[model samples]
Target chain A: MVESLSLPKDLVLGSAILTVTGNSDLYIENYKGILLYEDCCILLQTKTCQVQIEGCNLSIDYYNNEDMRISGCIRQIVWK
Target chain B: MNRIIIWLKGYVKVRLSGFSPERFMNLCGNRSIHVWGVENHGRFYILYMSRKSFLQLRPVIRKTKTKVAIIEKYGLPFFMHRYRKRKLFFAGILVFLMILLVMSLYIWDIRISGNYSKTSDMILKLLSDNNYKYGMRKSKVDCEAIEKLIRAEYNDVTWASARIDGTCLIVELKENEILRQEETVEKPSDLIAEREGEVVAIVTRAGSPKVRKGDMVSANQILVSGAVPVLDDFKTLVGMQYVKADADIYLKTRLPYEYSLPFLHTEKEYTGKKRYDGSISLFSKNLKFHIFDNPFPEFDRVEDTKQIRLSEYFTLPVTVTLRTTSEYRTVKKKYTKEEAAALCKENLKKFLDDLEEKGVQIIENDVKIGIVGENCLAKGMVDVILLMEKRQDTEMVTVTVPEDNRETEE
Candidate 1:
């Protein structure tokens, strides 16, 4: 029914919303799962795309099912 | 505000050394455990999670075969846990707070205001003897009783009031300096002119008005006379009755003044170097510590002092005093005759303003300013009108004659 109304998935279906502040703070909302996690890289799976965050010292400030806050010296973020 | 919320919810930083720490974190997330502050250090994953979630991570740790070590603990729960052993110390703090609260309910200080002739110590002693001393509970203070007691003991206090202001007891008093003298002896009086002048206006509220508007009155003339003649039919001579005459009479009079001002004046011109000195004053003594010397020979100093009050009507002994000084060079300023005359006119205007404030109406002003040698001389004469009242109490004397003289007059 939501898809028939033709509303944005992120707004109607509560899909993933990613926000980055400066080069040190990264926040993700409505994420589905985490695929790859390492010292310098983190991979987050959303309903529609994959969020690849590459940083020097990537660390998760906080993470739950609804929202997550990642803090480190972020070098790049890619959506695929 | 956010920090307070975070402090209430205890958190801890944990270092996880396992094959797949992210999987362990995901399991924890699935179980509704909120995790934060994840950092990568080689193979070990450092993360922060709430203290509640950290305790519930045993199953996840076992499943992932990870080594968990708490790096740091944060928030109030941990604080309470750390100080749980010091039960006596916490009890001592609680007792101290209770004592402070209880002490604040009583009077800690007393202040007196509006007192003259009678010393404050006498009033304090009077209050202490009447059970209104310091440390007395504010709720127990009988304000009306204390005021009455002070008034009765002093006899000179016209009015008195005692009130509790914060932690201080404030005693307000008004002293009667005149002590109700011969003024209470009422006598029939008349309002008379103090000096000779033309009457401008007359408003009589009591008795008969002897003078009208624009009437030229003489010195010591009765403007409102107290003596009123009571007569019967046929216009015969009758008895004289007296009354207290009250009236407002405005008179037209002239006031003259002369002033001389020098053309050259000495004025201080600021050089823009300013210094501020601050001191803490305790009990009227200023304690100042300064490491710098006065760099200028000539300067202007302005001192301002304010008392530090703990509450309204409760001033503490300590005060912060701040003084600012500006360096200036004294220079001789040469003024033109017009400028000097302007200065003199300003002075004259100020004098006239003062007179106007005292109910004087300026009718005409004849003023002249001119250069007399190097100084400017200003001469002015202002005609002003104001109400003047003067009266004296006198006993009415009766004249008695001898029997032969009385018979002859009859």
Candidate 2:
């Protein structure tokens, strides 16, 4: 399931992300559009794009092409 | 261009830069748009184009704007930087006004004071001649040079200085002081009898008594004299007199004049023509003009002149005046012996008449005439001396002790 969640108030979307307790190493994506990355930030087009993540204590990895990866303790998943 | 216009139709505003009024007008070239106005500020150029053309030519104009730095740098931002753009113009106007104010404060007129004999007109002329004149700029006038020139011309000036105060050039002068010689007072001196006769006047100021009036006294004899007395309380053994004495005495003398003449003509002569010139000096240079010249050469000439220096030290020439005189010559005729004698007697009578007017008494007279060298000459001499009486009052101070004081002291 794609877990949808509202961004935390203290979290900056481009610089960091939040993790919930649910899944880990879950493969996911039914993307509506390409999420381009620039300057360590993600640009999501059309608001309907979704992604699934497995982990709680999520570790984020930044890519040279300005993309971000998520891993670690999973708590729950959400989609919107 | 049509495509560019279609592309620009979507935007509400278009900006153009780097185009001056002339250049912009040239570019407009038959484009229908009202020209509002043109504004110039030194090297900066700003042209306003209507929205229609601005949009239509945006692509082409933008290419032009990039080529010109004034456009690319200042064009778009000038509207937002209005204050900075007007600063230079305002500063230039302020500087120009300041210069005008300074120039107006410079001296325009030079006024002199403390001048009596030196006329204002002459002083002004002198100043003008020395390049320190009216309407001359203050910076152009050298005060030292003016002072030197004036001092050189006017000798009576003790000192002179010039200064510029606002629009006035003030020239202050000090005149030289004239010194008068002191006269010496005569001490006690001999007052001798004036003439050989009786003492007529005796006025003793500070001397002992000598002789009284009506006393026969010879010339050089003391009348009211100069001698002081030393006395004892018993009123004895001291004698002296201090007196100023005068006397008038009568004397008789014999003198003769002879005249002889033959009928002969004599020439009468008169003076010659005269001319006078007036001169004034300024800055050591003299300006002179002759006021009068004798018209007749045969006439005798006489000239009179007066000169005064306006300043004592500077010795500036204030004014010089001269008078000229001319006299003509006339012929004279000779007279026979009889006529000569009669003329001599007439002349003698006229002389005696003059002497009578002067209070002289003629006691006796003798006359004679002789012919010599075909001319008649009359000779006569008269002896007469004045007899006059003068009385001079003498002041005598007598100090006497009162009888009551003497008795009381005794």
Candidate 3:
């Protein structure tokens, strides 16, 4: 039904959209809340699963009600 | 861009010490209170939030029971609140900006360049007469009109351009390579002999040659005649055609020269004594002070003054003058025979150099420098070759027509 209407899944089905630029920056939209935030790693929860970003020197540049930006040397992005 | 907005609205760097600062941040975020630059300290967390967000932090603080301490407050709203008592300082700033704004609306400097035959001061005077001068309104200045005015006033100016850059009005012009000789009509005159001399050579440009080469012409004799006789088809003189005579007539002549100098002369011998006086002048008023008195009757005084200025075009009415006085004694001195002869030769050489500068050729020097009774005398007769260009108006000729000739023509 969403594809028939030609709408993005993140906007229609309430799914999270993760945009990573190289190994340094990550942008998350349609996320539920921040499960954990540390200098080394950041864990965010979405509608269906929790997205875990593993990196070194990880820090949140800024966060608001709609999206969040994480920047550092990212090593892994595990979904659970 | 977001940082500027945050700064304008004011922000606080908060240090949360109690447990669950992350939960507090999450609650604040869910409620639409934006926070950024979140850093995790070992036992505490530090973050930045706007003033409005900090107000909503109270409810979040109570729910999470986290103690948030404002480490620093920054930006324009807080700065204004802290300096609310200094009204005069702010008013002075506003007045300064207003003055600067008013100053920028007028032209302050006028510069002219590329003018050679015409001086900058003369051009500036012309511009002032035409209302295009320093301190004129920028909006009233028309660059094209200025160019046209300069070209119109100076017939010799071949090209002109005017432009306004910032507050400076720049006008540049180029003068014609050749003088406006074509615009002026030459007077009808004859080239007469300047002096009684033998003609060495003659070159005619616009007139009939009256004296040939090697001809001995008398003083005031015509070298080139301005009235050229017109000839008909049968080679009969019909009338006289008048024209300005132009020609080069080189003549060989002799000139007399004499110079003398006194044997005894008074010379100055400077003594080893000096005095200096310093003074400062302000706004056309000067108060001079010196501690030393004049010790000698005959002394030379030299003054040097320097004016102070703030910028290239802005001058301050302040100057400093320094005066130096040196004592000198006059003594009678007699020139030796050799020195007197050398001095006469040096002066004679200088005179010849001056003549050479004026395109005159010196063929010989028979001058004699000898010490006479009580003085040195230099006398001679020098031979020279020079050009003559003495002109006088040409007398017109009238032809009387007979009554029978006039009736046949009618």
Judging by DockQ against the true structure, name the best candidate.
Answer: 1
Query: Candidate 3: which pairs clash?
Result: none
Can you rank all candidates by TM-score, best first?
1, 3, 2
Off by over 4 Å in 3: A1-80, B1-109, B114-119, B131-142, B152-158, B164-168, B175-179, B268-332, B399-410
Give a tens-digit lDDT track for model 1, residues B371-406: 898899989788988787788553343334346554
lDDT of 2 at B144: 90
Cα lDDT over the full model 1 = 0.80
Point out where model 1 deviates above 4 Å.
A1-80, B1-145, B151-165, B171-190, B226-244, B269-279, B283-301, B309-315, B325-332, B389-410
CA shift of B266, model 2, Å: 6.4
- Give DockQ per model, in order: 0.53, 0.00, 0.50
Report the lDDT tens digits of candidate 3 across residue range B36-106. 88887767888888888898877889999999999999998899889889999889989988966665667
Query: Model 3 residue B306 lDDT?
Result: 83
Question: What's candidate 3's DockQ score?
Answer: 0.50
Q: Residue by residue across B94-144, what tens digits does model 2's lDDT show?
A: 898895565454444567987766777888899987767654566787889
Kindly report which residue stretches of model 2 are placed more than 4 angstroms away from their true locations once superposed.
A1-80, B1-185, B198-217, B228-267, B270-298, B304-410
Which residue pairs come into collision in candidate 1?
A59-B38, A59-B39, A60-B37, A60-B38, A61-B36, A61-B37, A62-B35, A62-B36, A62-B37
TM-score of chain B of each: 0.61, 0.32, 0.60
Please provide TM-scores, in order, for all candidate models, with all chains considered together: 0.55, 0.29, 0.52
Model 2 chain B poorest 10 in a row by lDDT: B179-188
